[model samples]
Target: MPTQPATAALFPGQGCSLEGVKPLVQRECPDLYELCLCLLDADPFERSGDSTRYTQPAIFLASIARWRGLVRRGVRAGAFAGHSLGELSALTAAGVFSEPDGLRLVALRGSLMAQADAGGDGTMMALLKGDMGQARVLAERFGVTVANDNSAGQTVLSGSGEALAASALAAREAGLRAVQLDVTGAFHSPAMRPAVEPFRRAVANVELGVASAPVFSGLTAEPFSNLAVELSEALCAPVRWRETTLALARLGVERFLDIGPDAVLAGLSRRNVPERAVVRAEELDVTA
Candidate 1:
């Protein structure tokens, strides 16, 4: 038998649409879909209308459903990594907790993050054609913070509405394209600090198990040592995705499977490690 490539399964954070995932989940993982409806008290398939409280759990269910399909096909990974909100999904996939337990935690995390920025004055913006140096300069000038280092060329900043606007204008003047993200709060910034302790306490209450595979932390670009503490701290820390991808490559991950609602992570993998094979769940034949 041909040896399987060293693979890492990646879960994406928010900003991608869950357009066709409902049908996929309903067809392949009905129990999880129903559980989502029961726990959330709404149709998980319906549009979230950009509400973080709804989008978080919806994304989690979609990712897990796709992962289950992969598992049925005997696909496996050596490691796993998730971006921001996707980390909870990664933990569940790695057997750190049950799916239902993960769902409940994500639901509460969403609610806390949403409530943390009730005024809705906090937002995030992406900076393109810029390096981390420029991103840091703009962030310092505007009193914002770098939320995600998605790739060498793409960085996201999070802060107050006024700060983001000022940062965007500065980025444009500096010859970088600035685009505002369709998110509800300044995630990975000080604006999310209010949710940190509550989320930490909630994570502590859950029963955690040894992961079936190593799960890398976006905050530290290393395998998780303390999930509860790291997960909560991740709320206000930058997603070192570029570094995380590199770390995975260092660990001999030659194939990256993006097991999420969309191809967001796959796209990032291509840019972050072009030599590696990147596959999206949608591209796989799950009918077997």
Candidate 2:
């Protein structure tokens, strides 16, 4: 018998917009659109700029809407893992909480992250073609944290501008490519310590359930059962995306379907697990 194709659904993190998905959400999920309207006070695509306060919830709604569409078409995922803010979207899609409640939690998370960012001048930069161990050494020396371990040679370092600049220069001296990100906060690092406790309370207040599908956590890079414990620590921990993808692949995930606006995770998965297929959910032919 032919091997069954195992798939994992992926959601995009912050900095990705809902512009590409707004129409779909409005057309296919009127309830979700109404909730977004109440939460954001406008249609998701109405706000074009990337504000952390709005970006998280907007992306979460859009990602979930896309996943709902896939489910309607009988697409079944063996596992799911989202990148950063995408994790909330993943949880919502996996039946952990109602959409409205999940949106509220995401809003709180974004606000707390923004507040934590106000404590200092912090940011993130992607270091390309660098060894992870070497990058960790340089990051530690400059007090920056390796925020996102996306792939083998791709790692996102986060901290103050001066710290990032120093690390970038050192990385250049070591023949690595360093590019600054457009985000305002140093997310997934110790810089978000201020937000951790409050977000923990918010998550604790929520009614969570066992995941309908395996949810590969960014914190543990394994199955997640306790959102309060795992996600609270995620506020001050690096996103172990590379390990998550490897774990998914090891569990027979042959395809990763990007259900958010951008194909960012699909692109990242290409670098991490080139042997598997990566596709955007929107690209699927639902009409068939």
Candidate 3:
């Protein structure tokens, strides 16, 4: 028999919202629209623009839809992974939870994070280039925290706006590149602690199950069985995306399928695993 395609499915996080994708989802998946409507009826999207609850559900639907869409077209995946919020979607796709349950949990997560953000006054910044150790040191010096280790040189810093500003200035003075993020709160940092308690409580009600495939944990940079607890830890923990991607690469995963509305993970996978083949769910139909 012909060799099965070496495929790994990846999911994107917050920055995955691309132009025109949401509209496409609304048009193509009527059930998805209805589900979104139901979610709106409960807490409503307008109520939580920056809520982790809202964003998480939104991302999960987008990703799971794309995954189902791809499966409909005969595509197959051998492994699965997601970045930050995308990990929950990955877990669901890996058979950890049903679609409906995952969506509900994501919404709750968004709500908790949003409420936490309302209370904590903080900001996020992306630093490009320079030493990771140096970046961590700088963040500590300012009492800020490293929110994400996205790649070899790309990282996100989180803390009070003043502290973020101070870090940015320091980085600039040191000739390091940094840019402020357009985010409401300091996600993936200690600043998100307020979101943690509610999230833990919300997750306590969830019925989590074992995943079918290897599910990497953003908090541990390793796979774990107790996915619910691991996912809860991820809320206030920085995403070690670079390490996760590198681990996948080490496993000889040459092809990546980003099952989400946008190509955020596809792009990052390309950057992180340059030698591998990275394709987005949206781009599949166009391919021969």
Pick by lDDT: which candidate is best?
A: 1
Q: For residues 153-244, what per-residue lDDT tens digits would candidate 3 score against the true structure?
A: 68889888989899999999888898987667778877667767666666677787767668777777777556657777787888988888
The positional error of residue 81 in candidate 3, measured at the CA in angstroms, is 1.2
Q: What tens digits encode model 1's per-residue C-alpha lDDT throughout 124-176?
A: 99999999999999999989999999998899999999999999999999999
**What TM-score does model 3 achieve against the real structure?**
0.89
Query: Lowest-scoring 10 consecutive residues by lDDT in candidate 3?
Result: 42-51
TM-score of 2: 0.92
User: How many residue pairs of model 2 clash at the backbone?
Assistant: 0
Instruction: Give candidate 3's whole-model lDDT.
Output: 0.74
Q: In model 3, what is the error at residue 207, expressed in angstroms?
A: 3.1
Best by TM-score: 1
Residue-level lDDT of model 2, residues 99-181, one tens digit each, is 87888888788879888888577889999998689878988799889898999888999999988999999999999999998
Query: Which residue pairs in candidate 3 collide?
Result: 52-110, 53-109, 53-110, 53-111, 54-110
Q: What is the C-alpha lDDT of each candidate?
A: 0.90, 0.82, 0.74
> Which stretches in model 3 have alpha-carbon errors above 4 Å?
42-53, 286-288
